[model samples]
Target: MTPSSSSEKSFNDWYEDEHIPLLSGVPGWLDSGRYRLTISTTSHAPSYVALHRWTDLAAFDTAEYKTATNTAWRTTVMEKVVKKERFLLQYKGELCNILDTLL
Candidate 1:
Protein backbone atom coordinates (compact mmCIF):
# COMPACT_ATOMS: atom_id res chain seq x y z
CA MET A 1 0.00 0.00 0.00
CA THR A 2 1.63 3.16 -1.25
CA PRO A 3 0.42 6.67 -0.77
CA SER A 4 1.65 10.17 -1.48
CA SER A 5 4.37 11.37 0.87
CA SER A 6 2.15 14.21 1.96
CA SER A 7 -0.82 12.10 2.97
CA GLU A 8 -0.48 11.48 6.70
CA LYS A 9 -4.18 11.49 7.49
CA SER A 10 -4.84 8.88 4.87
CA PHE A 11 -2.18 6.62 6.25
CA ASN A 12 -3.41 6.83 9.84
CA ASP A 13 -6.99 6.14 8.92
CA TRP A 14 -6.07 3.24 6.67
CA TYR A 15 -4.11 1.54 9.41
CA GLU A 16 -6.23 2.28 12.45
CA ASP A 17 -9.69 1.91 10.98
CA GLU A 18 -9.72 -0.02 7.76
CA HIS A 19 -6.83 -2.41 7.17
CA ILE A 20 -6.67 -3.67 10.75
CA PRO A 21 -10.35 -4.49 11.16
CA LEU A 22 -10.97 -5.90 7.69
CA LEU A 23 -8.05 -8.29 7.70
CA SER A 24 -8.78 -9.33 11.27
CA GLY A 25 -12.23 -10.61 10.24
CA VAL A 26 -11.23 -13.24 7.69
CA PRO A 27 -12.12 -16.81 8.63
CA GLY A 28 -9.31 -18.66 10.42
CA TRP A 29 -7.39 -15.42 10.44
CA LEU A 30 -4.98 -15.77 13.29
CA ASP A 31 -2.99 -12.57 13.48
CA SER A 32 -1.79 -9.50 11.67
CA GLY A 33 1.11 -7.53 13.09
CA ARG A 34 2.47 -4.07 12.31
CA TYR A 35 5.99 -2.79 12.81
CA ARG A 36 7.42 0.69 12.64
CA LEU A 37 10.81 0.32 11.02
CA THR A 38 14.23 1.38 12.38
CA ILE A 39 12.71 2.73 15.57
CA SER A 40 15.85 4.51 16.78
CA THR A 41 17.84 5.00 13.60
CA THR A 42 18.15 8.06 11.42
CA SER A 43 15.55 6.62 9.07
CA HIS A 44 12.54 7.76 11.03
CA ALA A 45 9.93 6.97 8.43
CA PRO A 46 7.80 3.94 9.24
CA SER A 47 7.41 0.74 7.30
CA TYR A 48 4.93 -1.96 8.27
CA VAL A 49 4.87 -5.75 8.16
CA ALA A 50 1.78 -7.91 8.45
CA LEU A 51 1.91 -11.44 9.84
CA HIS A 52 -0.95 -13.81 9.13
CA ARG A 53 -1.54 -17.42 10.16
CA TRP A 54 -4.33 -19.65 8.97
CA THR A 55 -5.99 -22.84 10.17
CA ASP A 56 -4.28 -24.77 7.40
CA LEU A 57 -3.25 -24.53 3.76
CA ALA A 58 -6.46 -25.97 2.41
CA ALA A 59 -8.57 -23.78 4.65
CA PHE A 60 -6.68 -20.67 3.61
CA ASP A 61 -7.01 -21.53 -0.06
CA THR A 62 -10.78 -21.66 0.25
CA ALA A 63 -11.17 -18.67 2.60
CA GLU A 64 -12.02 -16.17 -0.16
CA TYR A 65 -10.20 -13.34 1.62
CA LYS A 66 -9.85 -10.98 -1.29
CA THR A 67 -13.49 -11.27 -2.28
CA ALA A 68 -14.63 -10.62 1.27
CA THR A 69 -12.32 -7.65 1.71
CA ASN A 70 -13.55 -6.11 -1.51
CA THR A 71 -17.14 -6.70 -0.60
CA ALA A 72 -16.72 -5.01 2.77
CA TRP A 73 -14.80 -2.10 1.36
CA ARG A 74 -17.46 -1.50 -1.25
CA THR A 75 -20.44 -2.05 1.00
CA THR A 76 -19.68 -0.82 4.51
CA VAL A 77 -18.70 2.22 6.56
CA MET A 78 -15.14 1.28 5.72
CA GLU A 79 -15.91 2.32 2.18
CA LYS A 80 -15.65 5.94 3.23
CA VAL A 81 -11.90 5.94 3.84
CA VAL A 82 -9.65 3.04 2.96
CA LYS A 83 -7.91 2.75 -0.40
CA LYS A 84 -5.31 0.05 -0.24
CA GLU A 85 -4.87 -2.98 -2.46
CA ARG A 86 -4.52 -6.36 -0.80
CA PHE A 87 -1.96 -8.91 -1.91
CA LEU A 88 -2.66 -12.49 -0.92
CA LEU A 89 0.09 -14.79 0.26
CA GLN A 90 0.24 -18.48 1.23
CA TYR A 91 2.57 -21.04 2.75
CA LYS A 92 2.52 -24.75 3.53
CA GLY A 93 3.31 -26.53 6.76
CA GLU A 94 1.85 -29.11 9.10
CA LEU A 95 1.00 -26.72 11.88
CA CYS A 96 1.05 -27.98 15.43
CA ASN A 97 -0.41 -27.05 18.82
CA ILE A 98 -2.79 -24.43 17.54
CA LEU A 99 -3.69 -23.46 21.12
CA ASP A 100 -2.93 -24.39 24.69
CA THR A 101 -5.16 -23.65 27.63
CA LEU A 102 -5.54 -24.45 31.28
CA LEU A 103 -8.70 -24.61 33.33
Candidate 2:
Protein backbone atom coordinates (compact mmCIF):
# COMPACT_ATOMS: atom_id res chain seq x y z
CA MET A 1 0.00 0.00 0.00
CA THR A 2 1.25 3.45 -0.98
CA PRO A 3 -0.02 6.14 1.30
CA SER A 4 0.63 9.86 1.30
CA SER A 5 2.43 11.13 4.39
CA SER A 6 -0.71 12.74 5.71
CA SER A 7 -2.75 9.60 5.36
CA GLU A 8 0.00 7.12 6.14
CA LYS A 9 -0.52 6.99 9.87
CA SER A 10 -4.25 6.51 9.67
CA PHE A 11 -4.02 4.07 6.80
CA ASN A 12 -1.50 1.80 8.45
CA ASP A 13 -3.29 2.04 11.76
CA TRP A 14 -6.63 1.20 10.25
CA TYR A 15 -5.25 -1.60 8.08
CA GLU A 16 -3.42 -3.31 10.87
CA ASP A 17 -5.98 -2.79 13.58
CA GLU A 18 -9.25 -2.87 11.74
CA HIS A 19 -9.06 -4.05 8.14
CA ILE A 20 -7.16 -7.26 8.72
CA PRO A 21 -9.30 -8.20 11.68
CA LEU A 22 -12.43 -7.69 9.65
CA LEU A 23 -11.21 -9.76 6.74
CA SER A 24 -9.99 -12.51 9.05
CA GLY A 25 -13.56 -13.16 9.97
CA VAL A 26 -14.34 -14.51 6.52
CA PRO A 27 -15.18 -18.23 6.46
CA GLY A 28 -12.12 -19.50 4.61
CA TRP A 29 -9.63 -16.83 5.57
CA LEU A 30 -6.69 -18.43 7.32
CA ASP A 31 -4.27 -15.55 7.69
CA SER A 32 -3.29 -12.11 6.46
CA GLY A 33 0.19 -10.65 6.52
CA ARG A 34 1.89 -7.52 5.20
CA TYR A 35 5.46 -6.91 4.04
CA ARG A 36 7.55 -4.05 2.72
CA LEU A 37 10.16 -4.63 0.08
CA THR A 38 13.76 -4.00 1.02
CA ILE A 39 15.10 -4.58 -2.45
CA SER A 40 13.71 -3.51 -5.81
CA THR A 41 15.09 -2.67 -9.25
CA THR A 42 13.15 0.59 -9.32
CA SER A 43 10.91 2.76 -7.17
CA HIS A 44 7.91 1.81 -9.28
CA ALA A 45 7.84 -1.60 -7.65
CA PRO A 46 5.25 -2.08 -4.95
CA SER A 47 6.51 -0.80 -1.61
CA TYR A 48 4.20 -3.10 0.30
CA VAL A 49 2.39 -6.36 -0.32
CA ALA A 50 -0.45 -7.96 1.56
CA LEU A 51 -0.76 -11.74 1.55
CA HIS A 52 -4.16 -13.13 2.43
CA ARG A 53 -4.46 -16.87 2.85
CA TRP A 54 -7.76 -18.61 2.38
CA THR A 55 -9.03 -22.15 2.08
CA ASP A 56 -10.27 -21.26 -1.40
CA LEU A 57 -11.20 -18.37 -3.65
CA ALA A 58 -14.84 -18.89 -2.71
CA ALA A 59 -14.10 -17.06 0.54
CA PHE A 60 -14.01 -13.82 -1.40
CA ASP A 61 -17.60 -14.24 -2.47
CA THR A 62 -18.94 -14.13 1.04
CA ALA A 63 -21.14 -11.17 1.94
CA GLU A 64 -19.24 -10.55 5.16
CA TYR A 65 -15.96 -10.25 3.31
CA LYS A 66 -17.48 -8.05 0.64
CA THR A 67 -19.08 -5.72 3.15
CA ALA A 68 -15.91 -5.53 5.20
CA THR A 69 -13.85 -4.43 2.22
CA ASN A 70 -16.38 -1.90 0.94
CA THR A 71 -16.02 0.50 3.83
CA ALA A 72 -15.30 4.24 3.75
CA TRP A 73 -11.70 3.82 4.80
CA ARG A 74 -11.03 1.33 2.01
CA THR A 75 -12.59 3.63 -0.55
CA THR A 76 -10.57 6.60 0.66
CA VAL A 77 -7.28 4.75 0.65
CA MET A 78 -7.87 3.07 -2.68
CA GLU A 79 -8.94 6.29 -4.35
CA LYS A 80 -6.37 8.68 -2.94
CA VAL A 81 -3.40 6.70 -1.71
CA VAL A 82 -3.03 3.03 -2.58
CA LYS A 83 -3.34 1.13 -5.83
CA LYS A 84 -3.73 -2.53 -5.07
CA GLU A 85 -2.85 -5.53 -7.21
CA ARG A 86 -4.20 -8.93 -6.37
CA PHE A 87 -2.80 -12.36 -7.14
CA LEU A 88 -4.74 -15.53 -6.53
CA LEU A 89 -2.50 -18.48 -5.71
CA GLN A 90 -2.44 -21.99 -4.37
CA TYR A 91 -0.06 -23.04 -1.60
CA LYS A 92 2.22 -25.95 -2.61
CA GLY A 93 3.27 -26.78 0.91
CA GLU A 94 6.72 -26.82 2.48
CA LEU A 95 9.93 -27.54 0.57
CA CYS A 96 11.30 -30.87 1.71
CA ASN A 97 14.28 -31.67 -0.49
CA ILE A 98 16.71 -33.37 1.86
CA LEU A 99 19.90 -32.34 0.05
CA ASP A 100 18.89 -28.82 -0.94
CA THR A 101 21.22 -26.04 0.10
CA LEU A 102 19.97 -24.04 3.07
CA LEU A 103 20.95 -20.68 1.61
What is the number of backbone collisions in each predicted candidate, taken in the order shown? 0, 0
Q: Show where candidate 2 strays beyond 4 Å.
A: 91-103
Candidate 2 lDDT score relative to the true structure? 0.80
**Lowest-lDDT window of 10 residues in candidate 1?**
73-82
Instruction: Quote the positional error of residue 36 for candidate 1 in Å.
Output: 1.6
Least accurate 10 contiguous residues by lDDT in model 2: 77-86
Roughly what TM-score does model 2 have, to 2 decimal places?
Answer: 0.78
Q: CA lDDT, every prediction?
A: 0.54, 0.80
- Give lDDT: candidate 2, residue 61: 94
Q: Clashing pairs in model 2? A: none
Residues 1-103, model 2: lDDT tens digits: 6676677777788788779989988899889889877898887766678888888778889998998799888777766575556678887777577777664
TM-score per candidate, chains pooled: 0.49, 0.78
